[model samples]
Target: MLPAVAVAAVAAVAVAVAVAVPALRHRLVRSALRRAGGRYRRRLEALSSDVRLNQERRLRRLLRAGTGTGTGTAGGWEEFQQRHPLGQPCREEAPEDAVPPLWLWALLPGCWDCDPRLQGSLLYLDALGTAFPRALSRRGTALLHWTPGCPRAPAGWPLPTLYCTPAAAGTVPSRAAALRLQLLFALRQRELHVLEAGLAAELHDALVALRTEWPQLARELALGRLSPQPGLPEEVQRQLQALLAPDAARAAELRAECARGFEGILQRLWPQLEVVVVRMVHGSERLYCNSLLQAECQGLPFYCPFYQAAGALLGVNLWPAEPEPRFLLCPDWAFCEFLPCLANKEPQTVLLDELWEGREYRLVVTAQPGEYRCRTGEVLKVTGFHKQCPVVEPVRRESQTLSVRGEDIPEEQFCQSLCRTLRTWPGARLIDYACVESSLLGDFSGPCAPHYEVFMELQGLRDLSEGQRYKLDQCLQEDFPIYKSFRFKGSIGPLRLHLVRPGTFTRLREALGSPRPMPRVLHQEQLLQLVQGSIIS
Candidate 1:
């Protein structure tokens, strides 16, 4: 009777234990992970602390040595501002002054790569070099970079990105072709992850296009090796054939049946995606975090400042060290000063304190020891301080102002208006846009006064109504009171919106040539062919 009682008690305990296991498993695992993540962050913070402390004092020492003047680098941040006045290019010379100060090239120190004048690039590259080894493996970074066309020759560095004029030549067609190429890459190297692109806008556009029209492409974008296919689709077959020639094609010929990347992207969840390497976010958005629409979809971003030259990296978005990329500025190289009056030909400048936060300033670069402080015309806003280094981000260019009637509308605000207008206009995604001052067209004596003329390139948008055009003006008026006041006083005419031919911007850039993309406020009359010709009755 006692043995029978013992067996019955043992069975009861076993049943209770089984019931507890299901509820306790996930809680136990999550608690352990939270503790581990906390320890990792604490360790990283300690390592960065010392580097953060030395940034300011070291920057002053370098400037003193480069300038060769003890007093030039002396004094508080405010005193430094008093010593060097702002330097701006001549208004008549627009883009000509915007070019590199090549004349000062002979005077700068530290070779071309390490020049004191080119401090922005120096700090940027230094940060990247230090972090690259830690964040990535030398075996392969798993960089999934995109190209406009396929190369005739195999690329060794940055992997020759091969893309060409699409079987069709328009922007949408070109992007569609490139999307297929990326999918082909995704098919190889199962464990490899990280899709890269030059601009965030381009990558976002490509993915959106793929998901909308050719979602069947997902099974191919999966992280797996080449599979037995009845046949490759004729649309993207040739490009894939050219790219994935078997036997570990070149670079270790990483061959694996990689089928898992975009499968859940459109349907369910994408927890596996690592990071999307984006070189720069455009001026359409103020902060990098807010700008990356692609990152919102499931990918982390490896953000870098705009310059692409070797060793010219600036801005900090240290990936693994910081959980999510900060995309914060607060560079240790040069200082920034607020432009007292952007309208004045001679505006005094005041250097921002290295520790100052929550203020906007024009970047006053200390370039070429002998040269005056360059008023880079780049407006940067200091959001907060990471120790002594003030965290900042590029706000907009002073040159992006459309101030024909003293109602200076900055690029950010103009973009805001554009954003509002696009939401109401169905099926239009921006390809590019250029703002033209109405006075540039020599119609000052017309029934209307000087105003803004916008030439835009769009995908999936063919027709625009007068009411739709006026909506932009309404948005602008709501955003900028000065602009509204000008319209009320009849000093500014109604804003004109023009939809240009496909590839209009591609041709415009080709015509403008390299190194000099005339400011947003276009002036050259000859450059207005497609723009003016697109005017509707």
Candidate 2:
């Protein structure tokens, strides 16, 4: 009889424990809901409008009613989910009734919650005032980023789109700004191509016309010879000065001209679209090398100060100790799905389908108005994941390498070595530089069959000494293991460094029929082209 009693007691205790556990869980969940509900109420009270306050109150009620542990609450939540599913229509023309339920709204970008209509499009504008008409034309939904100084959006911009702009009339809160600028560049690649081509042609034609007028200068440019000029004409000197010196003012003027030209095109293309301007504390948005929309300028990857700033604003560390220079985020991952590798083991077989989110790969992208699997030649590392999207950092270019036999020195490694060495010389600024294979020039032949020549445009030359140069060489050897081995074996000659004028790179770009910044790794063929175009002193 005692044994029977013990068994019954144990069974009763087990049943009690099961009931108690569920009760405890219910109590905790309710406690959490109450706290959340209170916080939402406090936030709601801060709203300046009765309508918004009422909406918040209603939203809170829905949360409280739907999120309880009761059977009725679970049923209510399920019904709500059915009404506002995650896979609901994602189009610009989504109907008014298609607004996301209050529960899902909090998790989305803040702009989406501002208006029921914003369910449709996302538009992001920047200081350049250029909109992606090609991309915009296709999507009804967009997130528009606007700077403080950008012009107001023209009427008839599709409703239900979120505009994340500075604190101004009709601007979304500052907290809702897009995290990456690559989304803008990638989405608007079509427009970027048009602009890049137009600018390059304009600049190229202008140079050709200048050559026609100044025949001697023209002849010098054509021959790529920089002979000591006994006396140059004032106009020719001015032109050469513009090309060779770092003229910030002149750069600004050219940038402004390009901006104006782009704006004019936009006005003609879509008069209803207002250009969004992105302003930061430094200054209003101005054109830079990244504006060219290529993956990198020379060996350096495409970088935007705005991207860094946005990351900082969000309290996220988006950059690494060393620059990766990759595309961090794209809204539509499909756009990057078809990018081909810039370099393959076999030159003839260069097409590659995707860059995995967590590895280093070459970048090639397809843009509309007809660009498909265009090899950008940019090397990028997948830094992290932005949700399911990959955050890429541009490291270097596939073409930006110096190879002598099996010794390969990549542009990123060289740049890093240069940076490390430059740090030893405080206050020294690197204006520009170019690297080319020596065999292309035929200046150093025989033993130096495949060598590299680095032309540096350095400012503040006082600190440069023989020891520093040796250290620079040592840094390169250390950075590139293969280079060190080749140097030790005497298979490759010592890398030669020449200090060029301040604007050598700019002049090179202009002479090369490219308005965009010149690549750091100028191949032998490009060097040949420069020599043919006339060497700017």
Candidate 3:
């Protein structure tokens, strides 16, 4: 019985050992597997991040090279494709048929003003056509598929077909409404493509939210009524308000979603496109040439020849010698006094006046038929003057007097004033001048002329080069002049200026002399310091 009990105990011990050993081995294997999986995931994430970073850098370079005076052609396309290689199928596709080809995509939408609906629709379409290529190019085409609506499909459009719901179709009331629907649809398509392409799940959700909000805003815009305003036309306000209601909660929600989505998109897209967001400053000031003298007094404001000529043609109301004068003095008193004296059956004289010690004096002036008095100051009493000024060759005056405030002058004058104040400084050069208008926003209303704002592009002591050009651009950005009532708006390209050479500059200085006075040297010194600080870095 003792031997049998001992055997049972040994058997029990052996069974216990078997169970313990297997359990230990299993735990070890499980731990090793978990560690390996964790390392693998980390490695994958790092690789993805690096890949995205590289792609972004390449895209940024491409965009920078393409903008502003670069050849935006097939070569640009080739370079882009080479940098961002498509997969095997895309590589096999011909240039004409391939979506990535620059020729296939329209960079800017066509001008279509007559139909508001069509215009809105086309604008969205153009944006998609332009942006999708870049997105897919970066993310790869496997994530995207194109589809067209039934109407488009019937017309043999190459994109993937997406059906517009009957309810959605009915919701669109006007041609403009239909256009907006199309735009939203295109945006939705792009969003899905981005998601499918393995973008973050959060990005997809944000985009979905954004698309849903667009339609609600559009509906509100369509329903809103117009109000009276100066800058905003009634029709425009009505349409815009309905589309983007200021108070609507849905609109705000949509805006937030869009902002989030766009940021994500930009983060991904910016690097690939090589896009640089250039900061632009706008101004509001009118540009005008000083027209005070001619011949002996050429370009001088306070002198004769020009002034006398102006007076002979148009009756002056006040003479220069008058004490407390009320009117300009002129020889053509008959024309100033309303007598018909010109051969063209028109009056050639007008009156100019100044008020001194509460008394008004009249100065007679004669001028060509087209010339009109632009001076504003004191009231003048004309003994006799005529109203009719016919368009004929009566007498041509080379220059006329211009009244400017003590503060206002050409950009050159400001620079010169500063140089004069700092007599020790080297002379400055007028490198460039800009009559910048107050907005950078493009106007679809056509080519409107610049307004009151003007900026003088002056070069310091630095030599001219591409680097210098860049520095100048930077300096302008930093030390930009501030206008209390006017702000810088937009840039008009290919700036043209009647540049004055060194000789011409000297001539102007000699002509103006002590009368006009040189610009303050201190002002120039300050400007130099400001420009140096701005551009040097």
Candidate 4:
């Protein structure tokens, strides 16, 4: 072993290399990119004016229309229940495909008064056919899902186009990655076209730079030459092997190196823009990934697993759909049997046995659409009735609940406690949260009981003093009766709270590289990985 002084010197040098080198590299790259990016940004801004105007106009129209409309009992679940209120042992089953009249379906968002379910709703014509004034592409299949009454295209507006490279959907993550990348590419191209031709010169130049780098960068990414990074999209993955060389001893190290390299390339290539990112959740449903601005800066409301539920309920009263054409609950949720939701304040699980006029159960639905007793896994608190129609606010997912030592703590309650705790401290906000069963419980020799380690990201606050932490603990206990009982009875240990830096959730999600939504609760191994990856303890 080296002398203590020598060891200390070596440690200092290693730390310097790890931190200083990255900082230096970032500074250099930023300077280089800024020189070229300035012109590009200016040009893009000029081109985007028309698109912005168009978007503004459309938004105004939507807001006006939404505000003008009222939610009626004509299309709500309660109304359906009034028609067929019970699920009996021998009663005739409602048809799974039971949809409201065509006129009603036309009222849906993006429906634009046109029936989307009708045969030949989309018209696919050959480019060489009489409909085409000029050929747009060399060769490819096309598909269109047409809706009427969408903001009418300007006179000179062109038809939309989507180009996809077919790939096998072997797993959810793989499928999601492919779809996301393709969609992202399509969006960039669409936005590029939306800008004014004269103002797009600088942007066009930037694209030229992109065009030059993309091919080589993509190739390097595919071959693991750029970086041995993980979580790269399928477009780049298709060119290379999924994993590094088959050496178990160094696999983790090699993969980490690759992931770093891929990240570096992405930072260099991806344009910085103020935009919201969304990913598909469970088929066609879209969910937003909390933006960096929302999480770290403004603390604007964004959907987390818990928030998804909490917000829905708040929406019922605060953003009532009735008397406001804009607000809707399950606007597209038709032809389904609602089943298996829980209460807002309790853990009692309810089955979709029947519908009463004013009672709200969890929104479980069974319909000819696909499955039976399929719990949408959502909780709903019913508001009032529009006629016999049920107006419900979404609560949270049943899967978000955590159970240990007979104590069940729902994610919604967890969020409520977190928000309540933060509210007491002005300027603080809760960004994201997760919990894991404590692995250290085994270290205690006498009457050891497992507990939870709660991890959270807070904006505009740091250094959670003991008193503040205690307040948080008390709030949690107050919110969860079972948890409080478990804690008092010595069935569980004191809750451990960990404050992580802002954007920690974003990093975790990116590291996970899955198209699936980030989970609100993590198991032991997952939690360990998250802690390891986090920016701060």
Residue-level lDDT tens digits of model 4 in 105-158: 432333432321221111111111112212222112111111111221110112
Candidate 4, which ten residues in sequence have the lowest lDDT sum? 193-202
Ranking by TM-score: 1, 4, 2, 3
Better of 1 and 4 by lDDT: 1
lDDT values for all models = 0.49, 0.38, 0.27, 0.38
Score candidate 4 by lDDT. 0.38
Candidate 2 contains a number of clashing pairs equal to: 37
Candidate 3 residues 1-537, lDDT tens each?
Answer: 569989999999999999877656644533433343344323323433333333233333335444543433244333544543321211111111122212222312232112212222222223232334332222111121111121211000122121221113212223223333333332322222222211111112223333455545434434342233233334434444444323344334444545554433322322232111100000101011111011111221120101122222222211212112121222221122222222356333222211122223322221222222222211233333222211111121101111121113334333333234224324544432323222321362146433222233343543334443333333333333432112234332222112222222222222221112122111223332332233321
TM-score of each: 0.58, 0.40, 0.18, 0.43
Off by over 4 Å in 1: 1-84, 89-135, 138-191, 201-273, 285-314, 319-332, 339-355, 427-431, 443-447, 506-527, 530-537
| Model 2 lDDT-worst window of ten | 308-317
Candidate with better lDDT, 3 vs 4 = 4
Count of clashing pairs, candidate 4: 25
- RMSD value for candidate 1: 14.3
The best candidate by lDDT is 1
Q: Against the true structure, whose TM-score is highest? A: 1
lDDT of 2 by residue, 116-164 (tens): 2121112121101122332222222223232222223321123222222
What are the runs in model 3 whose C-alpha is more than 4 Å off?
1-303, 306-328, 333-354, 357-482, 485-537
lDDT: worst 10-residue window of model 3: 277-286
Return the lDDT, model 1, position 53.
36
